[model samples]
Target: MFGLGPAAKSLREQEEQAITVPASKLLLRAVLNLVVAWFVFDEARGPMAWIVVQFKPSLATSVESSDTVNVVMNLLYYGPVALLIAWFFGRMGRWPLVWRRYGRPLVRRVVDAIGSRSGAGTPGKAPTGAKAQGEVVVDPWWAFRPLVGHGGLALLDQETAAGRVGDVDHQRLNRALECVRDYPDRLAALLDAVREHGAAACAHPSGTRDLPGRHSGRHDLLLRQVRLGSAEDVPKNPAAYRGVDLAIDPALLGTSLLAVGPAGTGKTRRLARPLAEALCLQALAGTAVVVVVGAADADLGPAEWYDVVVAPGDPASRYGLDLYGGARRLEEAVARLADALLPEELAPRAESARQALQQVVVPYTEAYGRPPGLRELALLLRGEPVAWDALREALRAGGGLTDHQYELAQRERMHGQVDDPGALLADRLSLLDRPALAASFNRTSERGGGERGGGRGAGRPGAELPLFAMHALDHPLRVRIAVPEHSHPEAARIIARLAVGQFLYAASTRQDRSLFAGLVVDDASAVIDVHSVRSLQRLRGAHAGAALLLRTLMDLPESLRTPLFGAVGGRMAFPGIAPWDGKLFAEAWGTVWVDERDVTRAPDTSGGIIKRSWRAVRTILAGERAQTESVTTRRVERRRWSPSDLAQVLPGGHAVLSLTAVDGTPVPPLLLDLQG
Candidate 1:
């Protein structure tokens, strides 16, 4: 049901009816069976049969020994008939359970025999111990109603009966089932893909990584957990999270995460890569929407691994990004655009920038019945007198302005056209008008058709690919946008910011919060800003989260450090971080009370010279000094992780991590061995 949406409710009800029975009816069946056996015994006990029986009879009973023996013999003959009757009526729910227990062993034996004939079951094993036990095999019928709740296995039986899943496909399924027997999540994913797609689940996204040799980690995407690594068996970790399968999940990530590490740390390998993989699989399963923003050089996954891959410079991939994010209200679109383009330094006075955008956005949208693209918006915000003349003429031609509104628009042009805030916005907007990003922000200004993302939101007629509109986040869309940060640094920053702003704004307003919305940025130095941090903090109540990876906290101004710390519920410190950066982490994790012991020695006050000589002689001879001493034990406050410990003491290939679930469950800072 995680991804199944409205259909999940109906499916759930059907499964409940199919798999369960009422407790009262079950109790009644048990009582009735006993009564039936007693009446049968009364009929059978005519003293015509004999077997082993007590020679001494009970005083309470009137029946003789020969009659009791007759009952036992008759009961043996009638047992099969009575059991068949109960199988059909009294214990309908019991058969499926019985099949699960007995049928599995039977199937295992048959498969083993088949394998032995083929010379594949020749491996040696101990015959008398637990190692001799057979595998827990897949029972498709038994698993149908309880696990793999999606439409995966739902159609297999029908297809099998119709001869659609052939002998080869049946064997294929059996082998697949053997691989995923312990992972129900993977089983559902596989069967669902084969039903909808006719391909293996790992191969569905155009690349195969969920296979054992391909992906080197344990993933339970059904529970929304991907094991990052094992926590080190050390005292720094609380017993609950210590030396176990440490992980990142919706609860921990729902509040957002800030991973601070230098280049060699396993931040990408341990954190971002696994989370992205889970989100991609979830998208296929209809459980999540994940937008991954990384540099063109980053090896996140392959191109076919995503539903939409927006690589602007790559001609083979031709998707455009929506400028307005498909907002209905003019003000909402304007605000989102302004929030994205405004410089981080001017956040405190952002209202002015918003006003500047609102003025241009309202007039331009009124004239065209659609919001302006980045190029058009940049023209308006640039305070260009010629651009203003063109816009006013278009508005007058459309008759979208009233006498009072027209007067206000005129004054706005005359006064703030060449002002600071609007000029700043114009400069920021101009960054997107570059050549490297020619394929992006091509959302055409056409009403209702803006969502089509092809020509409606497309570029260059016949060759235009659909634009990755922000509204797509409303569904379980898996999108990967690779910004060419190395070649075009500033524009990359803007694109990263745009993706972040769009995700937060669109996710906040989603009517369906069932899908977990996630944003992953590989190198977040260019992305984090004041408003984003603030917006991310407020995301706790929404159905969204983000993972921002940075080399250090110094990239942000001093004012934003605490806010960045507060915005995210999960924090990770990789080895090789600077002591100054570690200081903030030390402060964030705070302190813990620990026992401290102190000892004080009393000086000898015995008879003068003689005692002093004796002590010196003993100390010199025995290498010890004896004295009366006192000890004191008390609890004292100490930093949970010191700055020095975070920076220098952490071993290579390890990090200190802390997490908080979406429901406010906290995990203390603990060390984890990434290589493990």
Candidate 2:
């Protein structure tokens, strides 16, 4: 009012405008802030977040700890006020949230605004020269038209180029290319052209036939010859070449081979090398290498049972063998196999035996007991004769006894009483006749050690099974005996028969192809019948290969004869003099045999001198014995074996295996012992 200048007038006008803000807009903003503050305060109400603060007491005040409550209450009162202010300004505007509801419309508005300023107009439309900002727009050419009509844009081309491979377009192309019917010649021509072009381009054949050194779409077959020990020391090696090594690819083979020979012939030693090689392979690849033992051979006292014999630095030992490790492995495999095969039906019987042994013999031994003889035990065990040698083996193996504990206990029992040796032995055997009692005795013997410092209660209650468990991948059964033990030799035969039979079964049962691991059964005349050898043809049909070892070719029936002779894969013959045996083997082994007349022709030839030389040679050869060979054969002329056949006669250091061979060839005795 004091000045009339233009500047004064403008200032008055600005103040009037500033005072004219509408009450409605203010109310709306206040309501919005209040609403947002309510939510924030409500979320933070339950727990007051604590903050540590140190303050100097009011200098004029004498502060008491009890006065701290008033200060804390004051701080809490300001918390809600600070929270409300922060919520109103810091985040209230965030509720506009076009992203949650009106996102598309908001985006459209912003885009349109930008387009208008840049002279580009809206998107998806043709550019309008400089006014359009050079941005090409896609026109809705089909707009204003009903659903069915064609559009001006080249849609098919765009769709095809951007579509997935082998899409509808690709399928259509394939159908056109493959369209063939109504013209045989055209199809043939097309095939011929394809063959010319595709064949020329291919690096390998697509045919199923195998072409060595070239890829023929056939899987490769590997033949692994696993040697247990150095072949150079074959004579000193027993169990050296147990068979082929476990290096055998699981993809190619399912079984291995074992060639056993007579005692002092290094049969067991020879098996060792291959067995070791197999173990190494199995360990590295997590593969399984299984070796089944013949019951007869197991019954004998193989060096494998005597850990001390195979220990390092033993003079008589051929090589330091890890007997304990080997036994453990073998036992583990057998036990696993048994778990799978021992049927529920047999469980009760086995358990009964176990309980009897535990309750009767174990407690008796714990109180007042002594080791009994095998004969008396046999009488007690249902009058069935128990193998004395087997009992000895059990003792030696520490089946239920410490290394020498059983022997010492027995000695003490027999200490002073010496009346009727036979009666005494019989009575002792009868006392142990109960299988349960024997089992218990074994347990007590193994654990008790005559109660003299030996902890009879220490060992686990279960019987130390004769056979061990197999690894997971191997067959659940390590070995199966199919003979009635009515005859000692027959029982031995049954044990030996399972070895090769198992191999053949494994290889022959392939789902698709034959496992190329060949089976070898040496000395095929001792236990097996000659006619059974021909039954091995089933194996051939199954695509598996086999080699039969024999001392005489004639030992096998004529029906089982093969033109390949022994040359099919592998063959070997020891020097022998049985004329018929020699002739038969000469044919089978692929070696030429000279008659006495032929040798006398030169210094290495003819007549009386030749005859004498031939006889001498035969003598040298006859000095050695033969063993049973396991072979696969068909069921023909199958004779039912009597119970007598189940009786087993095991040699001290060796076992004899008897089985029906594929061809009617007698099984050669298979003599095997544990290697040192």
Candidate 3:
């Protein structure tokens, strides 16, 4: 019999047996052929034998006599066939192998067709009327639905019952919904609730409400919200409950920020401090450079990451910024210094001072290979004989001037064109001659060198870094120019303007957009002008911005206020705002048509006999019988937020923000709470 041996003891034993006693190729082929032949013969025999059996019954009368010899032969032929069939069955049974290969694939195709028709398992495409993710779909009937019973709250419970909403507090949803339920007319409140809570909370049984946080988290930078408006407005809008979020991108800052409010209204703590802290974080990460200009008494908090503090004209200050440093050329450097020193009010003197400084700066820079310090420049501008001798000697030693040029410079010095403009220039220059101020401008050595050097060229204690050496777009630097305007108003303005000019020059020179640079003027009223406004407008492409703070727009010149208002992309008007300033914001925000209704009462005389009799019978109707009603309606245009409303209706911690949208449209004024 052809039968397999018993199973091997192990996999290794099986391998060994197969290697030692492999089956013959011809014998295995013959066995396979015999197995196939037996199967075919057995299948055909079943039908043939059935037919023979049917005929045998009919022809069986002579069966015993006829089949005696045939019976033996037939039995002999059928015996081997039956034995072969049994052997084949014992070795290998007939099974359909085709179904194993194709069954799963065929069933999958049918399932896929059914799924496509029934719209199952497709994630990318939405149903016919369904909204895409992040899109707001509002219901028209949302305003009419009650927030509690059969409205948003009920819908939330329904969704929760269906197991849709997840990981949210049901109690909080119900509370928030109930809070805003009465103000169904305020769609924004309902929408904001849905956004903060879940869609289920904003879903009414009849429809779903979708509200997006458009100005919320739409940018990388954000200002905290303390409150929305008044306590009464809380139930009317979600902005009051959750507070309104202020989103202003650092890039748009070039358009500038103007914050107007009273002194104690959280302008510094809520607005300036928070913004400065955000910039400080960026500076620590090496993405931005910040310069904060404020009064010496202003509290900017502890900024440990700040790289430099340039408090010029301060007795206790560590370093000073070179008024003429960081310019691309000596002319530009001289022009910036001249602008800072000569106030715009002294136009003629400013021109002469600019010319005189330029005349000396060209030769002095050529002679010494670096621009002169403020004191040195002042001495050259004086044009005295002794100063000329010192300058000629310095120039001769450096071999910067020819004989004719030296003689020409000497003649010009004698002619007095280089003389100081007046007492004002001299006084301004005197402030720069202070030891601390001089030492700050001296960059020749590490620490202003020694006492006789007046700390000039000697670096400060830990690491003496100059403010001009810090590039706004490339380095991580925090510069605070704290000059008390009360003690030295002129000097404070000079240093502030110098810092502003230096920042503008450095930012404009940037070729790549890798860093966000900002200049924050705590009291912008002292430094803002046409030049600064133009610089603000031009610095947008260089990734630089300015945040200007003021007590009021009245602090600015009447002519400059309009330009400043138009130039800034963001404006925040706090309470105690003046009516004139409020008007400015009102116009910027534009107007809308509001419908007004008027009702009047008059005497009525016309009536039928039955009506007169009824009126006479009822004593209560006697007064109403002579009464008539008349109604009048009209549409009137009004400012969105009138000046009176802004000055009076706005709460202490709240502000009205007139911000520019990312798409350049004006966003309707938003009432925001700084402390919320």
Candidate number achieving the greatest lDDT relative to the actual structure: 1
lDDT, residue 572, candidate 1 = 91
lDDT of 3 by residue, 407-496 (tens): 335446545443545334545777766654565555553333212101123345534335444233455456677765777687778878
Q: What tens-digit string does per-residue lDDT give for candidate 2 at 1-676?
A: 1223456534544444434445454345445555656665666543333232224334214223446765665456447666666554433333332233346678889999997898655443433346446766542212212322343123432332343211212222222234443466754553443334321211111111111232111111212234221122111112233231212232222212223233343333333323322322222221222332322222222333211111111123221111011112323212222222222233333333333222222322322233322323323223223433444455555454454455334433432454312233334234333342233223233432222110012223343212111111132111112122223443233223333433444444445341133333333332233212333445545544443444344544554335323213222222222344333333442222111111112132335876767655433332212223343433333212211221222223332222222333322222234231
Give candidate 1's TM-score.
0.66
Each prediction's TM-score versus the true structure: 0.66, 0.25, 0.57
Better of 1 and 3 by TM-score: 1
Which ranges of candidate 1 are over 4 A from the true structure? 1-216, 326-328, 407-420, 444-449, 452-465, 597-632
Ranking by lDDT: 1, 3, 2
lDDT comparison, 1 vs 2, better candidate: 1
Alpha-carbon deviation at 289 in model 2, angstroms: 4.0
RMSD (Å) of each candidate, 1 decimal: 20.2, 42.2, 33.4
Off by over 4 Å in 3: 1-243, 313-316, 347-349, 403-424, 444-467, 470-472, 599-631, 661-665
Model 3, TM vs. native: 0.57
